[model samples]
Target: MGRSRVALKFNLGRGVLLAPLIFLTIFYFYPLVSILSVSLFPAGRIDLSGFSEIATSAYYHRIVWFTIRQAIISTVLTILLALPCAYLFARYRFPGRSILLALTTLPFVLPPVVVAIAFTSLIGRGGLLNRLLMSQLGLSSPPLQFEQTFAIIIIVHVFYNFSIALRMMTGFWMNQSRRIEEAARVMGAHGWRLWWTIYLPILRPVIAASGILVFIFTFTSFGVILILGGVRFATIEVEIYRQTTSIFNLPLAAALSLLQIAIMTAMMLAYTRLQRNLPLELQATRHTLQNLSTRRAYTLIILLVSFIAMMIFTPLLALVVRSFMSSTSGTFSLRFYKMLTVNTRSSILFVPPVDAIINSVKFAFITTLLASVLGMMAAYLLARRGVFFARWIDPLFMLPLATSAVTLGFGFIIALDEPPLNLRTSPMLIPIAHTLVALPFVVRSLLPALRRIPPNIPEAARMLGASPVSVWWLVELPLMLRSLVVGAVFAFTISMGEFGASLFIARPETPTLPVAIFRLFSRPGAESAGQALALSVILMGVSFVSFLVIERLRTPGTGEF
Candidate 1:
């Protein structure tokens, strides 16, 4: 009787595990594998012709080099900019520090379309900068036209990715016990020597991890390059979008997408190799914030905070102003908000910003649900280390994140758009596209929670003759509810603003919010443009709400399931 109960418990665990595997096979793996096959294999044959076109084409070679070079510059700049900020935020306590941290993190989550429009109104030819430059600065010509330039691309990329480096480094830095630093200072290490010897070495793993993540994100970046990058530049992602969507050269687009995947996969593999030797035993100490009292240190901190505030707030403020104030008419009106509710335009592509809001909310909710469930299951299975299909399944979930969404979108166009699948035009495709992008976050967020559960609890429960369902219901599930909720929220927000994959898969009738905002900017008319800005404002609000809600949900003492 005891053995039979144990067998039943094991069977229940296995069944719970298999549920996610089955889910992935249907929604995630099948779509991704099918897409991969379609991209590389031409019709009935495996061929190198697609790759050959990419390798041999001078245009593609230029794009590949530009992509690598810009990403490197962006990564390095982001690290430089983020490191000091991270140090300040993690170590120092001051008035409005929490507010400052929140402000810095705000832009990272805003929709790419919104960011692009905000950037355009600030720096474009007829933008505020140029107007100020010509009128106030006594300039005959505009000195700062960053549109379509590499400088613009790099700045935008840096602005977007700075938080990645900051968050990772700050988390790692805050975890560090001050004892080592105190010991180093006591041993006569001072100034740069202290940082060089004590802090740098300790921060190396975190730095490397953050750098790798930022590099991957910028390397495969799509939306920034597409709108802000304009005509002068084309990354592999932009090239794929242009070739496939605009030109209808699906074959060439597939080739470019495959090349991008190959490059990214190779780069990730190299990073993994380097990261393997990194020591993980350095644990963090519990933190209580400290004040910067020294004259020079306080001055420096103030300067850094001021610069970050300006960098983050100025463009966003410009966006807010443009959303409310009229640029073309040079007057203020509530028409933008009204237009958001009532689509006054006759364009076939126009979705009222209000409708887009509903669509975005629905899509985000579905994505959160699907990604959270799959991720929780996968994390549980992998945490055990000896679980069935663990090794094979883990990498598959991460592929969507590591690979460019443009590549995946291109793959989807080729694979699922056809008869055997024919899911390309389905309204559900956008949610699926979002889930693909959000799956990695789900897995990463849940892994720690899963690992925190002690193996002994289940064992003890089983020894007490608890049934299989009861053990999990009474033991494991209780510990995981918070993690699952946190992961779900991340998945939702990520999907809501997701742009790259949506570009290829989203149909005209069921456009997501980001897609709607882009369509607004694609043509002319000041009212429509302001409506887009207002919609962007709405997006920013939605993103902020989601982020705050998730933070609250993830907070300890709050029961979230």
Candidate 2:
């Protein structure tokens, strides 16, 4: 009877595993394989020529070099900027500190296109900085022309990714053992020596993890480059879209896609290894922020806070300001907001702009439901078991997070066109793709909470004559409710702001908010630009509310990203 029960349990676990495995295979792996096959067998035969052409071409070589260079520069700049802020947040408490931290994270949830537009509004040729410079200097032309430059690209990448470095490193730093630092100080190590010998070694792993994540994100950047960098600059992601959609070069697109996936997969593997090797005891000790005590400290803190405030808030403020300004009057007005309700016959969009909000919210709701359910199951399985399968399964679930959305969207176009699972024109594909991207976040949020539940609580319930299902429903469910909410919010916001996949899959008549904003920006005229800014403000509002809920619900010290 015991043997039979063990076999039953094994079968149940295997069945649970099969659901996600099949979903990933159909939606993720199959699409990837389709792209590879198209590239390698372009003419119903094996073709090594595409790979050779990519390798030998000087244009492709320059692109590859630029991608790596920009990513590295962005990563370094983000870390440098984020370190001081992280130190301040981790070690010093002040008025409105939590609010400041939350504000710093706002950019993370904004769409890359919105971010690109915001930066352009602040520093483009006709932007605020140039206008100010021209008016003050009496120049006919705008002097600060930053558009399409390497410097502008790097600056925007840092703006978009700085929060990751800040949050991750701050959480890690707050939980670190301060005894090492104290010990080094006592042993005559001070200033740079103390940092170089003690803090640096302890923080290396976290820095590495944060750097790798930032690099992966910047490497796959698409919307930002496309909107801000213009035709002169293209990442692998932007080039993939151009090659596939505009130029109709499928073989080259597939080859580039393959190269991107290979590099990202390697980086993800390295990140997984680093995470595993991180010291478990680093989480044992916790630190409280200290009150500012010295004049020097106050000066430093004020300067850092001001810099962070300016860096994060300026672009958003500019965007909001631009949204209200009327093109004809050059004064603040509600014209753009009112224009969103109008369904002009001459509009490029098939539907009114307001309908895009409805579509975005609808898709986000469905994505939250699907991602939460699947992510909960995956997290439960990993937390409840300590088997060989669990070891490999964790990384497999994270693969989607590391994969480029542009590549995944391209893959979907090619792979899901046939009969058994045709989803080409189906609106359902947007939610499905969004769910894939959001699943990793949901799993990350829930896994920690699930793991925190004491094993004895469930065992105690069983001892009191409760069935396994009853124990799970009565105990585990209640305990994990907050985390579940956090996960759902994350999934919702991700779906709402999703741009890359939606770009490929969305129909003309049923555009989501991000898609609508992109469309608005694609057209010329001040009216279109104003509408784009207005829609972006709406998207930003939604994301901010979602993030506030996440902040209220998330457990302290649990890393979000």
Candidate 3:
């Protein structure tokens, strides 16, 4: 009887594991299969025409090469910028270090559209410096045209990806013992010699991992290229968007989407293998903070300060300054902001900006809740490592994220819109799509937190005559809350600025903020575009403040939950 009960329990656990697998097969794989089916077997015949088109097209090849070239440049630049800064943040502690670190990380949480908008505000023709130059020096022509250039795209990619390198590498750096640095210092090594000999060698693997991750992200980038490069520069994603929606060529679009998936899958497979070997143990160093007194030290500090100031402050000031300036007058005015927030239109379909804001907030809330709960379940199930179906189930949730937005959007349109259930027009689909992508992040984020919880704590609680619920509430809930909140914030932020899926799933009647911004920017004039820029700032500001509050709550030296 006891054996039968154990078998029953095992079966029940197996069923629980299959829950997400079922969801994955239905929502994730089915949509992909549907796309492939439609593409390859359209008109009831298998066809290689789509693939042939991609193979023969020089335009497609050029776009692919351009994207790879730009992504490589951005990745290299980001690593160069991140390595020294990450080393400083991890190995040293000076006055205002924490604040500086936080500021440096600002670009990471800001939405892609938001970052692109900020860059445009700062560097576009007739922007802050250009206007100033014209006014002061009587210059008739602007020196730089940031829009529709490859360089601008690369700059935007670097701005967004630089922090990933810093954060990941810094975590690796923090785990290293100070004895290595100390020994190097004792051996007549100072400044560059010490970092080159002792630190850089040890940090290679971490730097490589971070670089690979950032490269994949930048390589598959769509938002930065579209807004910054305008119509001239096209990545695979941009091409896919143009081919499918703009030009209405489904075959070529399908081909590009498949090619993107193949490339991304290859990259992801390599990254996952590398990740398995990653050094997960991050030990806290106990060395006292160093003080800067020498002239060399002062020079190094000045350079570091200037770099940070230029990277963080300049772009932000440019964003705000441009937001205040009218593109018409090429002078500062607060009218754009006013036009953004003060919406007087009274139509249910074309709702006000305030309605979009409220819709976005609500969608973010629901998605965050769903992602956190589902992610916790998935993580808990995977942690056990004994379930029969766990191996197959684990990677399924990440499929939505690995697949390109254009493909997923196409998939969602095909799969969900027709059936016993039509979710195409439903506003809930936006949050659902956002949750699908954000769920993987929450799972990844919370897994480490859940692993850190000792098994014995719950057992001890249960041994003391406490029920399972009581044990969970008393011992596990308190410990996991902070990490859960962090994970939820990530979900919320991603949902708030979600574009790819939102483009397809969002209703004409109830558009998310990103969708609204895109709509406004796609029009004919600077008024709408400038207003879009203002909305982008508002979005970035909200996410930034939320992240700041969360970071403050989780400050170093604060006791763990």
Candidate 4:
């Protein structure tokens, strides 16, 4: 009876793998195969003709170089800028620490429109800072124009990815045993010497893990580059978009997509390997946290807090203020909010922003449900030691995240071209695309919680005559409630903010909020800008709500999240 029960549990864990595998095969792998077929194997014949064109083209080479170069620069800058704050977070406990830590996850959920509008409100030509400078100095031209520059792109990439480094490093640092540090101090090793000798080596794994995540994000980055980069710069993602939309070269677009996938898959394999080597030994971090011991310590804490506040929160505040202010009268008003309800011109694409909000919420609900179910199952399956295939399958699940949504969308167009699979025009395609994008995040968030569960408890429950279902539902589910909420919140917010794939898949009349914001921002005139800012503010509110949920429910010492 006992041996049979153990077999049942193993079978249950192995069975959990089937859902994620099937979902990936249909939505992820099938789309890739279809695009490759259409692009390189048209009429069942191999085609290197398109390859020659891209190879000989100087512009394509520059794009490939630019993609890798920017990602490397962005990853390095984010690590440098975030490490001090990570140390402060790991070593010290202070007022507003919870809130500050929560802020780290906010950027991941926020729409690109909000970040773009926030930066514009703070530093653009007519931005508050530039306005103040121009008025004080009586200058004819605005001094702070960063609309299409390389520096601004780097800054935004840093702004978006800084949290990845801080969160991962802080978590890893917190869980570390400080025996080495204590011994080093006793031997008179101090400051830079101590850090260079002991700390850097210990942190090498997590640093590489977080750096790879940032690199992958910036490597295939689409929305940020398109919104801020202009014609001066283009990544591989942007080049694919232009080739598909402007040049109508599907074959070249497919080739680029394949290249991105190959590189990203290799990097993801490395990340997963590093993740396994990461220390999982949990200890109470409160015991490790120190109070302000010296004047210099207090100064360092204050400086770190201030920098985080300025870098992360100031632009959001600026965006909120800008949204409320009227463009024409330059006074506090609700004109832009009112503009969302009006469609006087009766344009075919002019769905009211209100409807866009409704559409986003509706689709987000479906995405949250689907992604949570698949992600939770995948996490649970991997947490089981009996499942050997989980090792290879785990990294494969992350490929959806590494590949650009543009490539995925292109794949969808080619793959679902037949009847019954003809989901290309269906409204359900919106949520389907969103679920593909949001699934990896859900899996990442919940996997830690699943792994943190003690093995002894399950064995005890089984001995007490509890079935595997009872052991999970009555015991494990409650323990995982917080992580479950975090995962769902991430899925919902990601779906709400998704742009690149949504732009490709969403019908003109059924636009999502991000799509609407892009439309409004693209047009000239103060009214359009005002409307875009207002819509951006709405999206920002959703991100804040996600942040609060995560902050309230977070349990540390689980993993290097």
Better of 1 and 4 by lDDT: 4
lDDT of 1: 0.75
Per-residue lDDT over 1-561 for candidate 2, one digit per residue giving the tens place of the 0 to 100 score: 569657866886777687777878888999999999999999999887767878999998988888999999999999988877777777887777766777777888788879877887888887777878899999999898888888888988999899889987887788887888888888899978986898678778889988998999999999888888998999889999999999998889999999999999889888867765553635567877689898877887898779987999898888888788777776889999988976544756457789999999999999999999888888887777466677678778878878999999999999999888899989999999999999988987887788778899988997797765788799999999999998999999999999999999899988999999998888888877888899999999898888877877776556545
| Candidate number with the higher TM-score (1 or 3) | 1
Cα lDDT tens digits for candidate 1, 261-292: 77777666555444333323233455667787
Which pairs, if any, clash in model 1?
175-284, 175-285
Candidate 3 residue-wise lDDT, 1-561, digit = tens: 559657865775666566656666766777777778767876789987888877888977898898789889999999999888776666555677766766666776565676776766666675676767777888789876777777778777888888778777776676667887778888899978887888788777777777877887788787777777877888998888887778987767777778887877767666554543452434445344457767766677678878988877788778777777777776778877777764434344455665677889999999998888778778778656456655445556555666766677888787787876587788777777787878877776666566667788887887687765687688887887777777788789878878877776777778788877887767666767777778777887777766665555442322111
Go through the candidates in order and give the clash count of each.
2, 0, 1, 0
Q: Candidate 4's residue-wise lDDT over 1-561, tens digit each?
A: 869867986677666878888988988899999878867886679996667776899988899999999999999999988877888888887887878887766776666766888898999888988988999999999999899899989999999999878888888888888887889999999999987998888788888999998999989888889888989899989988998899998888888888888899999999988887674434423346888888988999889878988998888888988989977677999988999887745676578888999999999999999999999899888787777777888898788888888898888888886876889889999999999999988888888888878999887998798887899899999988898888888889889999889988889889999998988888887878888888999987887777777767766644445
Clashing residue pairs, backbone N/CA/C < 3 A, model 4: none
lDDT agreement with native, every candidate: 0.75, 0.85, 0.73, 0.85
Q: Look at candidate 2 and tell me the lDDT of residue 142.
A: 84
TM agreement with the true structure for every prediction: 0.91, 0.96, 0.90, 0.96
Winner by TM-score between candidate 2 and candidate 1? 2
Runs in model 2 deviating more than 4 A are 1-8, 279-281, 293-297, 344-349
